[model samples]
Target: MLGLESLLFLIEVGTLIPLIKTNKIKYNVEEEGGCDDLDQGDNGWKIIHTDVFRFPPFKSLLCAVLGVGAQFLTLATAIIVMALLGMFNIHRHGAINSAAIVLYALTSCVSGYVSCSFYTQINGQRWVWNIILTSALFSAPLFLTWSVVNSVHWWSGSTQALPATTVLLLLGAWVLVGFPLTVIGGIVGKNRAGSFQAPCRTRNIARQIPPQPWYKHTFVHMAIGGFLPFSAISVELYYIFATVWGREHYTLYGILLCVFAILLSVGACISVALTYFLLSGEDYRWWWRSVLSTGSTGLFIFVYSVFYYRNRSSMSGLVQSSEFFGYSLLTALVFSLMLGSVSFWASLAFIRYIYRSLKMD
Candidate 1:
């Protein structure tokens, strides 16, 4: 994406440079012989230079490209190192699950960069909001869900069954390594692009460009783009819990399960992006939209947990509605938080790409 964004920036500049030269030549011709058109002479050149160089669009693009490249490099390096360091094999029994986490983490990095890029493209106004959105949208739900699941006995017992020493070490490592790396990525992504200057060139450009209709694209974007992966993760969570407890198979099929999950993920991405785009009228709304989408998912997950507890009477002991609901909420909360947080940062990077295309300066 960063590479693509950079290439797009070059294209925008290439388009602009010719216009700049043409305007300058026209102005020079009128100014040479006491022409009455000062507006067509030095003034035109001044305006052209201002638009071409002093514009936010150009500066923002530069920042976005550099920042995204930094983040992508960092995350890619971190994951490669993590895998090589035997993080993948740390849990012998949960090798498949662990590997999946690593894979998601890697993919999440891309998502984070893309989303951030897109949001930055729309509204480069609030960095603090961007930071908070990133944290809330991507990290908060996951953290809450994990904390809840670890406390509850309803899901897979792996988190609960782990020795206190191992859990502490794992948490510490995540805090020290995972959190820092993510923070670094966010900082670079946010700070890299300073601003975008919208070109009010002739209304001709705006008139020629058809307005992007919202409804036309929302469903497909949300379904295939966002929800598919979400479905995959949710399904995976279900299996992880079921398998850990050696529960009976209530699944319809294995391949279908994967399909559902991938669909869910794709849907979730589109849902967050489209919802925010509608609310703020700025693609950059991902900063907050990420939070909203994640929160919405959590709400649904919490509700589902309520249903699960009420219907699930086969568990070892009858858990009270309050506790059961709490467990269910935790399940959604953890996954939602994780997903929301991931999407938030990813959305920022994505926004940057959009901004780069628009030539904000």
Candidate 2:
């Protein structure tokens, strides 16, 4: 299963690279006053000035028709093969589960690469950061699942050990099929949308006033602004470890988790809105500061993980196994990445909103 998961991940990565290169996802830009150094060229202005603002939500209708449309082709192929096999009744669960995981994983990689590439092109962020973050988000779940499987002692008492052929097939699938799929996905996304670079423009020095002091710096604002979101996230971590420490009653845990998530999301929105309101009043320094709120979650998760490890007695025996420890670390790492990703994107969107609000005048 681990090998199969790896294969799926690789395939998604393979597919993502090309997509990132080609796809031109729409990005919002602030149109500056017409170019000043106007040499009378064929097109009136010799240069164009523009500022990148928000990235619009993926044009869902178009994405549905093209991006998802292509993947459906593969889905249809899988359905056809499943129909041909008389053993469908017996093999249905394993086959469908494996296919679904691969398909979704591939889709995520493609979407991420496309989105990242588009943003990188617009903002001129280094390509390395784009690729690294995209890869981390798409492959995070796989590593988490692997950690869970490795940590559990299936052969002890009643746990059934997986057969040898299953393991081999899983390995083969990732190496042969998954890796190729990911690479191809990336390439396709990239090819469709090239990188974004903000167009340069000349500004009138006389008209421009130095941005106000409270609005001139981002650091302090960002650090303080991150608190609400981080607090909500820490509340969440408290319960997660509470459960891992042996409270298995889902009734109470489930409700609290849902509440925690909702409040966290809402808090994030409010923080952004507040920041935007402040920035709109000419506070330029507050522009990117609200985004720091999400970073608090990452800090809390790290601290909570320490407590979880120390308190969970069942995990003690597993800790003795290098395999179990490896799995535990993997699980922690992936969960942290997912949470961190959520915070980052939320903060980014908020900051973009603030940037646009400030520049609109």
Candidate 3:
């Protein structure tokens, strides 16, 4: 993803120029005493630069979610790259499934590390609680959803329902292996955690956000933001759906690799553009907005799933419907979190770079 990392870098070269010029102009003015009351009167981005890095609301919950989301993101990417490189038996059924399950169980360390490190940086006190939340956040929801769907299959006497032994094995793996790894990672991450450093010093009192136009509203930007990222991979998305839902065989690993890169690029660039727009409009509540904006790609995906279910596929029966929609929801939610993290991290880098460019006194 080194190339993909240039997403904001590529777009910001043009967009941030105006932002840079404006700051330079302001910089020349601030050299004198005329703009001494600038902090009080300004509705520009620099005013809120301080608050931008403030620990987000629900700091513990947010950190845990981000940690788990990031772990899954890494896991997904790793599995794809490994499959692309032929490190596994991609042609065999259940090979990918088995590998993914094993890798996910092992990646609890990542979840714990990121969660505890982030929580510590935010000055959080309850490290154990935060790590526990991180480990359980995604897995708990998934298990519950799986259990419900499996029960539905069981009632219909379908073979899709997991066996009792399998269920017990899964639980045992998580409790015995995943849980301890998470605890170890949390301990290490806390011990090695760094201080939270902001690009600018936050003001004692938060400045009231200036009124924004309707067009600049979060949802409005999100719709456009989501569309761009979703469009980038719509073609590949269809193929992915076909492979998952139909009898389509996807052997184009190279194309899949390209699409993966494109997905990250689209998500990062769109997020940076949207974040820039919001910042220019003097709205600083971008923490969740950036995530929601790019994550809305999942919304577009869910809509596509509906269309696929109704018109494309002839899938019928309670078991099929339950499985299709159940897994679809999980897929969309995971996609949202994964891409949302990519977007947020890209936006964070863009903000940091822009702030660094500023001639702050």
Best by TM-score: 3
* Model 2 spans > 4 angstroms off: 1-107, 110-116, 123-133, 136-181, 191-227, 233-257, 260-267, 270-293, 312-314, 317-332, 351-360
Q: Which one wins on lDDT?
A: 3
Evaluated against the true structure, the overall lDDT of model 1 is 0.44
The CA root-mean-square deviation of candidate 2, after full C-alpha superposition on the true structure, stands at 20.5
All candidates: TM-score = 0.42, 0.47, 0.86
Model 2 agreement with the true structure over 226-270: per-residue lDDT tens digits: 455555556555554554344442224345545545644754575
In model 3, the number of clashes is 0
Would you list the C-alpha lDDT of every candidate in the order shown?
0.44, 0.43, 0.80
Q: What lDDT is reached at residue 212 by model 2?
A: 46
Candidate 3 displacement at residue 299 in angstroms: 1.8
Clashes of each: 74, 56, 0
Full ranking by lDDT: 3, 1, 2
Better of 1 and 2 by lDDT: 1
As for lDDT, the candidate ahead, 1 or 3, is 3
